[model samples]
Target: MDLPAKTKNISVILQKPKYAGNIGAAARAAKNMGISNLVVAGSAKYDQEEIKKRSTHLAADVVEKIKYVDDIRAALDKFSYIVGTTARKGAARGPFFTPRTIAEKITAVSQNNKVALMFGPEDTGLTNDELRYCHAVVVIPSSRKFTSLNLSHAVMIMCYEILLASLPACAEIPPKLARSSELEDMYEQIKTVLTRIGFLNPQNPDYWMTHIRRLFNRTSLLARDVKIIRGICRQIQWYNNQKNT
Candidate 1:
């Protein structure tokens, strides 16, 4: 496939952005950079007037093609690589990448795999807990004195960097991996079984589950990996039923 076609493999995701204008601007930015997919995660509603005004005629198609999902995890499954963009820097953000480097890497990966570049809401960037779902974090270097970027500006810079880089050819297509939705289902099942077996404390189930999610997210589990882990959860539940009866 050609380079622009490779860019088509990227999905630009907005996570609960508060303003419709930001969503519209991000879509415009994506279109300007040859990206086609635009997904909005979480419950935030959009104002049509704002979207149209910000997108203008240039990105009208993108505005029309926008997808809405209930949450960030729900929107992530199909993509092989998930990159979270943030201005914050610290230990908990996981592996960090400069915008330029990550742009090239993501472009190369998109040759055969779906890639997602996600942005958080305007008020707060992605929560630490929300970021656990990302495989890597991309930080746009800015003056530390004033680091926070507007939602649309951040998306624009990331997309622009991607457009500047060249995607390397893949010698072989990678194996089919589990989608985000499938992993989410597996997590639910695991949580259920663990809760039933008293492995997850009722008082603070999230504390333990948060760690589990982060651990597994780093692995980028394949379809088979998900199946094997889910099978173990099923067995545990079955054994519990037998013991109770």
Candidate 2:
């Protein structure tokens, strides 16, 4: 039977995963639970063939579309809500939720915006530096000495629980596509205009394009919005040209 579209905001992000097998199995978990997107952060393994071999014929969709990112902050900060999965004890306040509670937090955020659920490296779990990016840290309820779980297994267990819990109360979530090409075109026009007006230095622009790309992606832009933006850019650029020459 074909699975329904995922309605929750939870997206599992693997940080610098070492083994292709682990990524493959993790994809299977997300796929089995009907999670569509799996994001990988850092200079990591995201090869299709390797993941396919490890997936064992499951989660082919996730394995095929896996995205790799060099910037951890860009990956984590893009989403409004975030959760860090780690079994380590903490001195300060943190909700030590069961797998069910982890699902709950995901649900709570799903009502509004996107979420990033992060898992750490293989040998060690999430580092303190990475954990700080998360709004809350979740500790899977387990034995004290052997509380830790394998990277992929932990994601699978959590994703499965979330998917199971949400099935009963699931509603129809319409498709949200990122047809961002129009936005990209508008940015190009904006850059041209800014350069013409001397607002943006073309010769020695300090990563301006990169920042603009990030900013544009951050906004929930639609195709129609891009058309309007393009027109505005043209008008402004024309006005600037007329004023000067």
Candidate 3:
């Protein structure tokens, strides 16, 4: 595979989420759009682990990468361009645009600046205070009667728009997940080394190992990484056994 490319950096920032499912779904949507960074700020639901499970149909490992933060400011500290998603009008900050337009803005800024797309919680769209930091706001232009959207759906719509806007002219096919045989060999090596160190506890070991396996599996570890980790574990075991003797 080619070395990781220096591509456009686009981040999704979720503020004060009340549920983990929504966060997970947001993560799925972000990853689907080729956006790898998901930042969660403010309060979050405890069941977020489940959210990642449900939202990430095939990209659960990607969902696992979502980061939690305490404030929106911290969430967007490093981005060169920031856009807020909201339905409010004539009040926030500068000029506003539709989701498509926002995506276009993202593409434009992306040529030179990393961009951050910010979304607020389900209960409320972006609070006026958060808008103070935005370069512009992208409003969905919903009915005046009820403009609210479920957090995940909101993320999905935004991601779709962004993906549509940023589709490459040549569109290089993205890389595929690592093959399973390679993953199995890596797992076996890990189990062997763990057993040697007494970490795997041969007696009734399956119970604990099963859980660890699930966690690592959820990460969709690449075969290359599994081999690297296995080698490290082998070296550690060799060094430790030598010390004991």
**Number of the predicted model whose TM-score against the real structure is largest:** 1
Number of the predicted model whose lDDT against the real structure is largest: 1
After TM-score superposition, the amount by which residue 168's alpha carbon in candidate 3 deviates from its true location, in angstroms, is 5.3
Tens-digit lDDT track of model 2 for 1-245: 22332344557889888787788888787777767678888875456677888776667767777778885666765565566788777653244566786675465445555767788888887886676555556787777778768787888787776765665544543223223234445667878887777777889553465455445544545456667878888899788879988
The deviation in Å at residue 47 for candidate 2 is 5.1
Give lDDT tens digits, candidate 1, residues 209-228. Answer: 87787788777778899999
Every candidate's lDDT: 0.81, 0.67, 0.67
lDDT of 3 by residue, 49-144 (tens): 687686756767667777878777677766656678887675324467788877765665555455678898778678766775565678886667
TM-score of 2: 0.63
**Against the hidden true structure, what lDDT does model 3 obtain?**
0.67
Candidate 1 RMSD to the real structure: 2.9
Q: After superposing candidate 3, which stretches have Cα over 4 Å from the reference?
A: 1-8, 43-45, 168-245
The count of backbone overlaps in candidate 1 is 1
